[model samples]
Target: MPDNVLENVGEEYEFEFVDVQSTPVVINSLGSDSADVGLLAYSSLANAIQNEMIPGGQSVIAPLTYDGPRYADTYNSTSGSSITDINGLDGNTLGVNGVGSAIDIAARVVLTRNDIDLDNVEFREVSFGAMPSTLSEGRVDVGTFIQPFFEMNSDDLQTVFDTTDAFGSFLKIFVTARDDFIDENDDAIRAFLGDLWTGIEWWKDDDNSETRLDIAEEVVELPRDLLEALVQTDRGYYHGEDGLAIDPEWLQKPIDGMAEVGFLDEEIDMSEYVDNSYLPEEANTEPTIE
Candidate 1:
């Protein structure tokens, strides 16, 4: 957590972190005022806004990460599978984390771009942790993996393609708050964004890479060696720029792609939903390092 590294921020504000794995639950929690701020994939948040799940819609405060060359959501098959490439996936079993999740949408976009008929392929919803084993055991011909899971099991799995091929460097996850919540607690939101930027800057520095992995190990159940491997290969998280600012141009790719694949009811103008006012001044400036 950011508070772990930024003790002074924690001293100023009190925070209670809740682990809600399901995206729908996160949306509902925000709607009911059960959660102040929520983390959501681009698809989930866009769907919630279109459907009016949250009272006054959501205000996207900051972007968490984007799918890019260094790191991205992946499509994988067994090390020695018959399906060697994206074109060969026709009529084969495809596994996704969820049917309508962000990864699922990305898979559809990739398949569509390859001219693979969506109806001809079978999609099985599997957990990320189980995807590797599921492919290894022949339960599914191909599975989708994100982050450490793909890096951890790379030796046993072969990549078919990543989301970058279809969506380019698109927005993946972001931080959001209910419209009413932002209106009600302006100061708190700014403080949180400021603290979050501080944490992001600290995490981006090369000097603190080992410490970042250590913090990751403490929070997640993965081993230190595995975490080290992920960091060493640059397969870890990619928080864009210093202040964690939202880039409308990068976000538009997914918005257009989701509509093209019918994942979203209609394309949305992200400018209306994104609120950069809450972010600190540093968010607008370029990073000192890269």
Candidate 2:
């Protein structure tokens, strides 16, 4: 999402952007009432729900994006050699951003889906920025990094598989709010969501490529050409021209898969945790993209 996407919402509503470390921290901030609304990875949200970290919190919207191949690139060391597939990870150490994070859970799902023995592999915690360097120095056999990293270091890295390869059409990120906040600020919430929808639509339009690239260049500090290439690649924001929407069935699948993989102790109650009513009418419908 853009840094100031909500700027156009209007004078009546004000939005605050809090930069945090991880999804768990985002959930904790929400639960502690330190944050009014926050976005979190689907798995982390599930973790919060399962552990009752955020009581009466509801997922207001899930910004679904689906470019095939996704951002989950598992790679070998600097040589970009030695690993060919999931089985290649056996008996090797895999570096992830965090142990119990969304990426960690995604790595588990991908590895287990290939029938790789989880016990045979060691998951080491590595920072996102350091993942490439760590893998290059032989500190870890395999490591995962998100966009621009893979694009930036393709020569030094070799892809085993992306998360989409293991679990197709997964929920990427979701927005959550405390029930009290939603109850008292319904109109403000609607206005915020409607403006958010406008931004998503603006972002997904092919005609806005240059404008988007300019913004990307300023924010990510990358070359405009590289950002342009990423935009061309089937980057799945999973949203459609219609608007952003939360699909119960879509949301349930990943939680169920995570639970099945032992990342989550139990299944989550979707009805209790999701409040689609806060979504703008245009965004409350089924997802327009397949």
Who wins the TM-score comparison?
Answer: 1
Where model 2 places Cα greater than 4 Å from the true spot, the runs are 1-8, 64-80, 235-242, 288-290
lDDT of 2 at 136: 82
Worst 10 residues of 2 by lDDT: 66-75
Q: Estimate each model's TM-score.
A: 0.92, 0.88
What lDDT does the true structure give each of the candidates? Answer: 0.80, 0.71
**Model 2, range 98-157, lDDT digits (tens) per residue?**
877766777788788878899999999998888888888888888887777777787777
Candidate 2: which pairs clash? 64-237, 64-238, 65-236, 65-237, 65-238, 66-236, 66-238, 67-236
For candidate 1, lDDT tens digit of each residue in 1-290? Answer: 55366643565556787789887789988988899799888888878878889987788888777777468888988888878889878999999989888888888888898899999999999999888888888899999998788878889888998888878777778888988878887888888888778787777677988888888788887999888876635586567654456667667777777898987777889888888888888775532222
TM-score of 1: 0.92
